[model samples]
Target: MSGDFDTIRDASSSDEVQLVRLLEEKIKSLQIEIENLRKELNYYKAEMEKMLSPPLIEAVVLDVLPDGRVLVRSSSGPNLVVNVASHIDQKLIKPGVSVALNQRGSTILEVLPQKEDPIVKTMEIVEKPNVTYSEIGGLEEQIKELREVVELPLKKPEIFREIGVEPPKGVLLYGPPGTGKTMLAKAVATESNAVFIHVVASEFAQKFVGEGARIVRELFEMAKRKAPSIIFIDEIDAIGAKRIDIGTSGEREIQRTLMQLLAELDGFNPLDNVKIIAATNRIDILDPALLRPGRFDRIIEVPLPDFRGRTEIFNIYLKKMKIEDNINLELLSQLSEGFSGADIKNVCVEAAYMAIRDGRNKVTMKDLVDAITKINVKRNNMESMKERREKYS
Candidate 1:
């Protein structure tokens, strides 16, 4: 019995030794595999980092936009923008060109290729009809005031500068609806040789999400680029109105856009040659900040046309139409008291229509009177009045 027990123990000990050796070999193989995997992973990680960290090369502009933005192509067959200043001298740019980029990894246009024929863009200036001081009568006082704000800015920059003053950052034209505030803005831009960016405040009031804010920023930046620019916002009361505590989401967004505009104007250096002029029938609703001294520094009343202004406006429109000798502009102007510039224009159009319907070649006083009566009736219509009131109120 002792011999059998000893033999069994010996056999068991040998089997245990063999099993331990096998397990050790398996562990070693697993370690080898893990080490190999680790090496491969490290290699892949290094390759990925190298690909992502490749240096970006500066590219030269192949072309530019009308706004003077550069469009360039990258070596990787992707298009990119070079950070060349819009004011960079055009003579410096040539095709197959290369430029050193600023530290921002943006390229500056440097070399131009001789073989490349680049596209040259020319700007065409369309002149709006002149609204001379003579064209606007009876508002000599208002015209004189506007001339100081509009005409003097360009005419007397040196005098203004010597006094350590810049032109008004903004001007608000407000009064009865259709009083030619918009027309005046156009005329101001025309007279000043300034670029004009026209926007309606209501457009900002209904924008999608962050678009309004982005558009506002872009507009200011664009205005900066186009220095001596006029940014005219019509219906200014819609977006510039003072905010209330119970604001809707849309209203809040509009307020944010307006606040951004205010900030941009506040930070603006008047030397940049940008001015803001807004027109609204209701200035009472605009934010007080918009009317502050350095911002909307000047508030001009574009009131209903007075008798003489109306007469001049009448002649201006009448001169364009076939009118009978019997048509008296003085009488028409006197009769259209409390009418706006737009109202006068419409009356002329309506009178012409009446004359045409009557198979007449020239518009006469009877046609004018009939048109005026119809216009009055339409103005007195409850629905139309309600709409106008809602618009301005």
Candidate 2:
């Protein structure tokens, strides 16, 4: 009876061990199942959130309503009255502030930071040019006026205030090509150490309607933000041409761009330290309004340099060049009448090239004469072609 009892006790112990092992296995399986369920729940939650999200659109604030709503011009081609989100501060909902709008509800989701317009950003001069006042020659009077008009206003505004006279708002540098109008602007920019933005008028005239005007707005806004800046518009005639009673959509868009530019020049917001310099070869074609006293206070004509001016230009270009001692600049200046400062520089460059081609160390008087003769021949050929075209037309 004792032996039977021992065998039964051992069997009972073994069965208890097996039961415990089974229970452990069941708990482990349940934990894994619970983890998988949580993962599935998370995945469903993400999908639900995606479905709940709405598309956001970009818009520019036009005006603020008295009742606390805002007027926005959507990028999608319509002006809208959108509700500002309750969480957003009302102060940042002012006109001109960019905002993100919910497409479904037509509400401003968030006030967006003003982004730098890519076009205007490219227009600004990132690195100031390596040009200075000394480098510019034969435009002493022009440089003087530019300093007083652009530099003084930014550097010493008190002088104008003390004299009880308002400084010029803008300067126009009109001239034939290569007379150094653009170079003068560069000198002023370097001397004043101000932000220089150089943009061509053709670029300002966008093909799309209202696009050009928008660029003008952003341009002036940027200039204002970067105070004590210079805005040089080369070839102003492209957009500033006289307005016509009737024209194509493209022409109308350019006129619109010009109107925006005029508005900016004579706008209510006074240009404190910002100065404008516009250059054009065809000043006659420009609108009369653009040349007005208030808009462009100084209409400086950078005409062809005189003989003395030519001499100065020659000296400026020849100073650094290695030439024979027999090189008489005054004679060269006299021989090269009607040649622009740029032409004179080109002559010097051509002389250098001739010497290099001949395996010579220094530019000789013959080299200078050869370059001048070569350029004169080219000019004569161009003039003959132009005359033939005119005669044919």
Q: Tens digit of lDDT per residue, candidate 1, span 1-393?
A: 999999999999999999999999999999999999999999999999978864545564455556655666554556766666555676565433555444455656344332221110111122343545555545666677766776677555777888887778788888988777766776666777777667777776664465667566556655554556678888878878887663677777887888887887786655556678888888777889888877888988888878888898888888889888888888888788877778888898999999888889999898888887887777669458898899999
State every prediction's TM-score relative to the real structure. 0.68, 0.74
Model 2 per-residue lDDT tens digits across residues 78-180: 8898898899998777656778999753799988888988877778573465578898778999998888788888898888888778877889999988999
Off by over 4 Å in 2: 1-112, 206-210, 268-271, 390-393
Best by lDDT: 2
| lDDT of each candidate versus the true structure | 0.72, 0.83
> TM-score of the candidate numbered 1?
0.68
Candidate 1: which stretches are off by over 4 Å? Answer: 1-138, 382-384, 387-393
| Error in Å for residue 285 of model 2 | 1.9
